[model samples]
Target: MDPQTVYEKLGGSSDSEFPTLHSEVARTEGETPYLRHPGVILIAKPDVDIEGLRPFLEGYGEELNFDAYLDDPTPLPPGSLLLKTAGQTCYASFGPKRTYNENAQRYFDNLSSSGHGSVFEHAVFSFFVYGVSRAITHEVVRHRAGTAFSQLSQRFVSGKVLRFVERPEYQDVPTLHKRFEQRIDFLAREYDEVAEELVELQLQGDPRLVAEARTDMRKRVQQSARSVLPNEAETTMVLSANVRAWRHMIEMRTDQHAEREIRDLYFRIFLCLRLLEPMLFGDYDIESFADGTYGATTDWRKI
Candidate 1:
């Protein structure tokens, strides 16, 4: 998720928004704020276990055999899990609780039968996402059902030159390739020079003046600097999505052609959840849209 997404997730301002609670959701109906879905959701702290997550991160780096199921419908690796959001408001206008609540109820009941349902709602995750454009943040902020986010802000910060996204097919043709690279390179170098000069001066000045110069430089440089950033330069966001919102994120972001970066991020998040909370996760599925949606088009909005 990007900063814009964060801005959007926090939706309508309120004291209630920050101290998010399940009970408050009942009052949110049409009154829900327009905040963006947080890029990363952090759960209520005391319940978390750092040790449980280590294995999930580690497993991502391991190699897997894809040849065995090359021609068939194969599921993701076992350690991978679901981040279901069948009722998220942003991705889809879940008709109402009457429809989605039943799914949630059943899913939890199934888990309860195994004696693990109570902890299901307590489930949480920190999703680290990358490679999304500011443009997409518009849609991501809508899954406000249950989650928290931390994203990169452009308002108070400036980027390190702009990096635009380039597709593989376009790069294969020299005509389009050279122009794109040159444009990106020129802006990158220009931004570095200006920001560096400003930083060096601030380092040598009095504290107050240093602050002033830093501010001035950041503003001035960003004025022209951001012009070079490409829509696809990678952005990293962290989200604290609960079991419910996870399902929603998967429904939307995990679909074909969700930005490759977000798709990759959602996949990682799904896999992580699958490992620690299997009983709660087993009911949801990610394989539904894993194949070709994104590869088929340039329209990332579909994700």
Candidate 2:
């Protein structure tokens, strides 16, 4: 009966694709260390009824205080949905819709509260995530159906630089914040210098010594590097969710307890979708979990 559990069940089960990190001719310093967005094209549309959008706000954004969210349901509209989580607050909204009429894309630019009239499954999305933990990835990869994920490997790419998602609680303790930042800076510089030096030192050293030194260097690198990087550091990944998945992600990530960065990302993505169809997404309601997964009941009518 739990919403998220219901949604996960829809996916049948789940799958995590282990991709090989091909050793290609590596690029230079800029953008190389960061997660590069592997783009995937997506397209779709859903029919919406603006007049029906009013009665639709009933259970939508169940967590927001109506006094602050809309005050009156007569002309109610959802510009954005905010989630309160461990990392940061997230926001979601719908934009106007565009329809194909007589071989032309008719643009409807309306930003308001309108029910997305039950046509989300028509759209879909794909994404790639790098340098992330199995933990966070597990949470995200759970969309089950209408969602696909390709992740970096520990055996291949090596999590020697295991990254983490930091919580906002650390910010409250000024000392922890400074220490974390300082560690991040120091390790990053150390990794760059060490990796570079090891490569250079090995080029001239005896082959056997080079191998030994490489192992030692990686250890030393991981030492300081690991300390600087904690759970909440920035992670790079390309995420795509169709209209349905988008709504699902927004409802979950925008809850009052999701991580900050992920919640922020979902909010932005939701806003983008809303821009595409104000009537459809605007009209739909949402239910959220404290842990951040949107409640998905088996009863589609309820959703």
Candidate 3:
């Protein structure tokens, strides 16, 4: 889906007086320029099919029974259920002595404490991450394992309405903020002018080209013109990662020493995950620092 649609899906407001790259307007100072903060929407998650798992549990052995868990009125969250099931399958631990509904949290707690993170790979979550700077996405894509990313391509997408992310450090200082805004406004104008020139240049070469060919030519020109865009340019991506990968990213990105922008981004991500599956992300202890940014720590570091 397009970035605008994803941003709106993330609960970002569509109405803004200033121009925005997407539907969300994180911050708007005046009528001319606006700034945006990174946004994340959990679009997809794991869903456990108890009936599908029923056959496997039945075939495992007669000594173990998962009837109670299967029939429990309240079930574990899908990710938690999938992880617990995977963990139990490894040891055939399905029995009345340890039940899912009553003991899922404890089971996951042991998994975290004991560093059994492989089962976490069984549960995956997908998010549409937007309103972030390209710099932040550069760092995000570094997490290559057990993760998938589909990011917006400056090559194919026009930069006609470029939006920028103002650094947290610059926001409080009036001079710095004004300078940053001026730079962004200048860059936006330059990008538009350059793109128009390139488009004209292409048309001059072959004005008779068909509609499809014109589209291709426009993409080519945009690709070249986008080089003028700064690292602070807002971008969008769809990131899908397993629970283990998410934990690893959260632990690393939300550290005190991490870059403030990305740290804030991941902390927001952590909040989303915590709300979705507390059993999965409850170990994190989040705190706000003096700079008004947040950091998170977990005793279960690598798990």
Compare the candidates by TM-score and give the number of the best one: 3
The CA lDDT at 118 in model 3 is 92
Number of backbone-clashing residue pairs for each candidate, in the order shown: 34, 29, 0
Better structure of 2 and 3 per lDDT:
3
Q: Mark the regions of model 1 whose C-alpha exceeds 4 Å error after superposition.
A: 1-121, 155-180, 193-213, 257-261, 286-303
What lDDT tens digits, residue by residue, belong to model 1 across residues 251-292? 567667576545544544554454445444444443434432
lDDT of 2: 0.39
Give candidate 3's root-mean-square deviation (CA, Å).
6.5
Candidate with the larger lDDT of 1 and 2:
1
Once fitted onto the true fold, the runs of candidate 2 whose alpha carbons sit more than 4 angstroms away are 1-119, 125-138, 150-167, 171-173, 197-230, 284-303
- What are the clashing pairs of model 3? none
Residue 292 Cα positional deviation in candidate 1, in Å, after optimal superposition: 5.2
What Cα-based lDDT does every candidate model obtain? Answer: 0.43, 0.39, 0.75
Model 2, range 1-303, lDDT digits (tens) per residue? 332233233231223221112111222233223221111122223232333434443445545322222232333112111110100112222211211121111111121113231334443444343433333555777776666555543323324443333333444587875565556555556556755654565567735324455555444434433443434333444565555566667677655577544553454344334433444354434455554334222122213
Maximum-lDDT candidate: 3
